[model samples]
Target: MANQTPESNQPSNTQTYGFPIYAADWIPEETVRSKIDKDQDNSEDVGGESSSSTSRSCIVLAGGGGEGRSGIKNVIVICRVDLDTKSLAEQPLGRIVLGTDLPYRMAVHPRGGGLVCALPNSCKRFDWESIISPREGDQGGEEGEEVINELKDVGQQLALAFNQEGSVLAAGGEDGTLRIFEWPCMKTLLDESKAHASVKNLTFSESGKFLVSLGGPLCRVWDVNASAAIASLSKEKDEMFAYCRFSVDNAGNEVLYIAANTERGGSIITWDTTTWKRRRSKLMKNYSISAFNVSADGKLLALGNMEGDVLIIDSTKMKTHQLVKKAHLGLVTALTFSPDSRCLVSVSFDSRAKLTVIEKTPEKRKGSKLAGDVVVVRVAIRGFLLFLDGKGDHRQRK
Candidate 1:
């Protein structure tokens, strides 16, 4: 793919965090609120109405240059996104520098359990309290804090995720081992040594009844209750599976989506959760998808490609609602949607993080509350610019 530059005059709320960001996710709103409440209780000035009612969302980012003596420090940092000001914090609220151990992938618990990061040889869990409330003698008041006692020595996991309810935790190992454990307790639910050639991605269904694992050429769906494989989906032709996610349609029916790339282009293949059969495949032009995520409400699907372009598709129509050309200068490493589904956060190897605000223009016709096909995406980065779609003109958002 050819390198493309965004409009120079367009404003962006982006930040260069020194180190490249490989994994990023929004801290749950409830979690943030809890932290705020805790701080208020400890402070002499007890809040009456709460000063940070409108504070912007916060996200955790983890990545580094590895153990190559590259000077860049391996670290995990929390940053605040100020929507009111349309800017990212110049500095992180908290940071932890790991000398040599690099965090490859991370999953933040949905219900404020904590954060689980994929390290070189094992997956370690970090508590939310420890990260937000730094202690003395700790590096940046965030380092040297021991990982959650239960998650020690879990083995080298390539993917880590917690179900939406935060009751179940799943880990996919580099050696094709898949382990599903009951959260907090760490009781084993399912342990498959040969779940795949190498477990690349793992996602749980909305109901937490099924788990989808993708690696190599196959994607398998496991029955969570039975702790056994229920269905296996294989790639067709030259298609290569990249990411998998579970979402529900407008009618509240469960659907599975798999991001796949082929010689032709990147496409999203939807599957029927009931029969585990292919439902539909939507191609995304010539872009090879590198990162994929669905909004919390299951209304929008976000995709970041190798060319640094970000596309938002309406879940119901599966049509491209908005597209940002050259959203980053390097491969887009990760994409995540805010808990409210109002904003999307994307990070790239360029050491830049951007937040795109979703603005829906709903059309009311004869008592219908359906949103219009057109979605004006206000991308808040270096400068704010509104994009309609691929062919639409870009204009400054007032």
Candidate 2:
């Protein structure tokens, strides 16, 4: 779907990737910065023009036509987002064809080591070096190096996550196995063959001391140091848990947020980390949530519904801060927050991706008596279109 540009706002751009997009994530800022530094060093050695000063970010997208003979190739793509221009590069910076293997899920290492992708029957690792600096004959949108032999035979993972420090890796498999390993070394820390009926979602706490896993109607919190499930969370009547996230409140207390759906609508349920008890439940939408994400700062929450609407909520008030109607033609497949938490990128099965910029509004007082101590804050969300696979046009939406 083409986004309409508003005269008062920056224009949004749209790209169609031809194949369905199942996974998307921002390349770590450290990885991009290191690449820029390496490029500068190479340019200086050859006395070539230096890199552009304009700020840019990179993101990786993975999806394909699966194992069937659909003609379209399974691939991973890297695209650069130009912050100055507020648009994606005309063409992808890199693309890795995966033959018939479809990448269903991915988790990029926080320290720029590489990324691991979940395929049909197993998972594979793709190093950052191979992706950013393709070998000779790897140009012109062709495949890069072969998938790294590491992680081979690791069963089909439905959920993958890395600890905040990137020192630990967690993978939840479709066979109800939960594995946690020391990063890079692959030493097992925890391996449960029956952690759930089928793992669906996983996340690590900020302190890296706890991990949360969601499968079927039960959501489990694991004590990382003990390597055992400490708490088992179950859904209330008619409420189904779809996703879970870890965040910290203003007072620095850890909070667990779960996206849930009921016959009435979609809701955000908060739980206290200390007791693992439901703290509050707020209904956010009338449609089932298809995608959900929490910003790094823990101040904002973003979610997309099956009805193609996106809503940004204030974590403090548990109220809607911004809502974008019909952001996608299909159900949102993934949503991720930028490292700086200033922007959010969302992708859908409709072969479209969007970049939504979050701008904070000036603070306003709610009451005269509380003016000195309390202030109400709101944010404006503006979305830009990102066209991929050489299809579609650019337009801005506010």
Candidate 3:
């Protein structure tokens, strides 16, 4: 993909840029979706399909924000590209040249007004409005400009999240601590160390009533206001959990889903928020889950794997699971869906981000069921393999 110029109203194709700046080998562990909305000019594709304002999702990338790079350093960039939008997708709307190193972690503010990034021993905030502007501005001088704020120190910060009301910010790091703060102000409210052995993922519930933290072999739930561990979902002293998130439903109840690796393969577990207990744990696939994201509407889930495939799973109906093989040429770093659920944005260690149109899955008539014999056979094979391997979530069948 060719580089895009600094024009927002031009054709969407004319605004996409490829990210070859400060390329690195290891993939970042986080990817976040942006909800900011706007209207833009139209540009018809060669095939006559308009690639204009219908973009529900945009792909953004962060590199060493500035150009010249000595080896690889931690550089944060704010970029947005709509569905069918080009790559590199022009320059990022915002950038931060922090001296932190790789394995970048960032979160888009729930209100879509700001962004927070986490690095080793530090965390910082950036204004989203100015980052997206076509014009560049100085730091802390004007509204929507590059208003960079260094949050209070967070030791070895590994993950960051904003509450649903956008009032609270959470940062989790290597010291097994979870830091909750008032947004913008960055005032520390609760410092809960010993949250885990090492906090790999931290997320707030849709209602901001609960927070979920995932560390290797441990999953703990906490009450937001009380700051106490309310539940522990599932843990294996021998296994490790790589990713976890809250799946919100229409009824406003939230379900906790986590990805873990086993001797058999990679599997997902969903815990009931009401009882703070796991309701289901099932094998999602054989591929190691590297990244996953849920659509805001609570209907869809996207999973990226080590094999570079993105698995689209239906939250309500399990049969709608579809696979996009080799969605990335290398290890996929992050994958996210647009607020409207019509587009998907993915980035990889290949130093590139892509905006892909969502394809409609062919419909299947309701009440259809898998063949009983086929199901039995498949389960028999899997059980035999698990038996040979000596251990698994034995309660599960297929």
Candidate 4:
């Protein structure tokens, strides 16, 4: 794709001048009918299996390009391969067309039924309609119920994060409160004290006993069963402007990690959940920290910055391990580790993502830089690497 340099003063352009624009081209209408007919015939001949299925796995993405900027423009199913692959072997799923009034956020529910989407306005309740439905005598895999109607009063985006295990869902909103919902029945089990600001992120501990909320400068840890704030961590004498993100260890120990940047600059703070003890503080330089991730095993911590540097730290020793400077060309928006902790992945605003396998190295490479560190050693069953990127594309790292 050719990079375009727009005039600095282009009135309607939201991007900066000299920035590379990234958008899928609208298919030409003149060729639509013939392509549809050919695709239909191909599907019928193949017993409903898509041709791309002969090659790679596919995932659908939720984003813009629908009608009026709010309508259901189109759903894109990418036949994605690992970035290193020369070609992908995935198939495309059929697109469900809708008017320009579709929700801003759509989530695939844990129950494997219909999804819950957050629509415009303060509307709550999931507008659920069937999107994919399993057939008789069929085992549920890709086939599942689809969503059609809007469930009113479902709450806003950024306030909720599902556990993806089909058991628990946590939501917080502008009302400065957090609510935990149990699956299948979808009832509000617990509602905690009001937060300091609109809750931006709600995360559950690995064991699902605790919920970490990122809102104001102070990050609050809530007990899931008791439905109360167990601990709140903050910087001394600072206004609550939290860019906080958290993760838990395999033992379900809560670790609240916060990053804030202003005229006074930023620091990455790590707190122990059980005692609410401030374990360690790292002073940052040159760039502001953007996002962070803690490994499932709780040994490694990855903090990404705006300057594209990803500082991999040793959780036990509280020191830096490996530093991938300019890990991504653009702003790093997301970071995630595999279930087994053998690899890591990151997504960026630069319109590209990276999957880096945690190479097993000598013990010298492991502990020499960061004390008592253990590098990822082996692959999981099925030879699949556990790294995951949050950019709508979830693929097994080979």
Q: In terms of TM-score, how similar is model 1 to the real structure?
A: 0.82
**What residue runs in model 1 are displaced by over 4 Å at the alpha carbon?**
1-12, 34-52, 134-155, 362-398
lDDT of 3 by residue, 33-95 (tens): 232333222212232334444443343345442323544444445554544544324544445
Question: What TM-score, to 2 decimals, does candidate 4 have?
Answer: 0.60
Model 2 misplaced stretches (Cα beyond 4 Å) = 1-12, 34-54, 134-151, 365-398
Cα lDDT of model 1 by residue, 1-398, tens digit: 01113563222477778888899999886767767455544442542322354755788999988985887778888877766656565556567766677899988888887788887766667776666665465354434344644445756678888998999999898889898999878888998989998999999998899999999899999999999998899889999999999988888999999999989889999999999899999887788999999998889999998889999999889887888888889799999988888888899988888888887745567234222222222223213422334224433332
Candidate 4 C-alpha lDDT tens digits along 160-238: 5556465877766655667777765767677654675667666676567778787766677788778788787665654
Clashing pairs in 3: 16-89, 16-90, 17-87, 17-88, 17-89, 17-90, 18-88, 58-81, 93-131
User: Highest lDDT: which candidate?
Assistant: 1
Model 4 spans > 4 angstroms off? 1-61, 65-151, 191-193, 238-254, 262-266, 307-309, 327-329, 365-398
Q: CA RMSD for every model?
A: 12.8, 14.8, 14.3, 16.7
The C-alpha TM-scores of every prediction are 0.82, 0.82, 0.71, 0.60
